[model samples]
Target: MIAVLFAILTAFSNGSASVLQRRAALEVPHTDAVGMSLIGHLLRQKVWLAGIGLVIVAAVCQAVALATGPISVVQPIFVIELPATLLLAGFMMRAPLPRPVWLGVAAVTLGLALGMASAAPGGGSSAVHGAAWVPALILTGLVETLLIAGGLATRGNVRAALLATAAACAYALTAALMKDAMARLDGGGGAGALFTSWQLYATAAAGVGALFLLQNALQAGTLVAVQPCLTLGDALISVLYGVTLFGEDLRTGWWVLPELLALGLIAAGCVELARSPLASGNATAPARARRVD
Candidate 1:
């Protein structure tokens, strides 16, 4: 339960950060899709800095959640970020969420709850085998590179989705590595031991890469184009990592139906929410138009 609370907080912090960062990214001009110059420009913006702060908070919460719970459990919880981001974006834009949007929100909430309850994921070893490290990192790097290349080759929403997918992969890898690092920390390995562990550094590197890709995604297109890809891709890939790398397992048989149904609800809700006017990040009315009598 404590881990669930931390994961919820992580979602809120990350969702808020995404909105702030996206807003800031759009305000700046970019010469290239994934250039360092764009990140440097974003770094100068106060709003982007604020977003980075929230990202740090989110990272802390995520770390605690991963340390205390299975990745299968914690990663699915991140799907909440989509609705949370939509809400924050709507509030920031001073746009009221419509009835259908509310319905989508409810669906996501209920589906996530049902899915988690039905999955009943079992705990697993946090520390992955030393031999698994090289292959896992290599595969993750290759996938990220491919996604980034594909994103750079495209334009508009397609590009954003690709970049967000790449970012999701990086984040998923980061969480897996962080879980390993946390496990090491708790295994009587003093704080200094983290410095010697490759997982710590790898997590940092992946996290930075993920942040860069995310900012690019935000700049490439609207949140509607980016959020769903990031939200879903990360969750699914993290579940795979939890199962393959950490040996976690979920409930079987009768529970499979609810979990599948829950995924459908989540998918439906994500699509609906992403198609809503207010979620477009450009549908906000003018300041005076928002003034109530």
Candidate 2:
């Protein structure tokens, strides 16, 4: 249960942090993606640094949860962070949210709560021991390679969101992968035991690479558009892997379809809220000035 709880907290924290960062990014316009990222970095240096620290905390929590719970349990907890984020943004950043936005936020939270509570999910990896460095290297390489190729083929918003979605996917996968990596290290595996890794390098590297793309996406589009897309995209990708591949073993009962329906409602509502200027960076209301760190 500790694992499940922590995963939930991590998801919430990550979403909240992303929302804050997106808002801060909005402070400047007329800048290119690289330029905007740089400026945004400068504008919220202290805040982002705190956020980085929070991410460290989140990483720790995720590692713990993955060790104890099924990937299905863990991943859902992480995905729910989107709603937690909206609440956090409301309190810390004073982000102006309309009634519709609040309703959308409620939908996400409700859907996530139901989804998480509805089933028995079981899962296990091939090994309890391996080298961290190996997985970190491999996953990161794969994601970066994919994006670089995609970037060459695409432009405009597609280019940006694709990177962001990739980054979000990487993040979701990273948590599970890092948890696996940590499991190995804890069980007395030395750094030299590189070959015994399950898929550490692949997952870790993928997660980091995805983060790089997310920054690019944030640079290209408004937080309103990018955040929800990333949130939903991560949920879809990670959960699919968890259920179909990880053998999360979640039992779909009476609530499964309803839960899925709720989840969709929440996602749609979030998108609708994001479309509003008041919920967006360009029109960040006066109340939204609080730092989400």
Q: State each model's CA lDDT, in order.
A: 0.79, 0.60
Query: What would the TM-score be for candidate 2 when compared with the true structure?
Result: 0.70
lDDT of each residue in 1-293, candidate 2, tens digit only: 77778877677656655665655555545463475567655555666566666667777677677767766667655545545555566666666566876777677677677666665556655233335436644664686578657855787666666666666667666655655565565567665443477556766665656666666776776665565667666666556556544545665767678767757875676675566555454554311211111
TM-score, predicted candidate 1 vs. hidden true structure: 0.79
lDDT digits (tens) for residues 1-293 of candidate 1:
87789988998888778778777777776563377988888888999899889888988898899988889888888777767877888788567878888888898899889988898886788779758878877888898889999999999999999998888888888889888898877879778787788888988888888888888997898666776787777877888899889999988899999988998888778777777765555565111100000
**Each prediction's RMSD to truth:** 6.2, 5.7
State how far residue 199 of model 1 sits from its true place (Å).
Answer: 1.1
Superposed by TM-score, candidate 1 places the C-alpha of residue 196 at a distance from the truth, in angstroms, of: 2.7
Worst 10 residues of 2 by lDDT: 284-293
- Per-model TM against the reference: 0.79, 0.70
List, in order, the clash count of every candidate structure.
Answer: 0, 20
Q: Name the best candidate (by TM-score).
A: 1
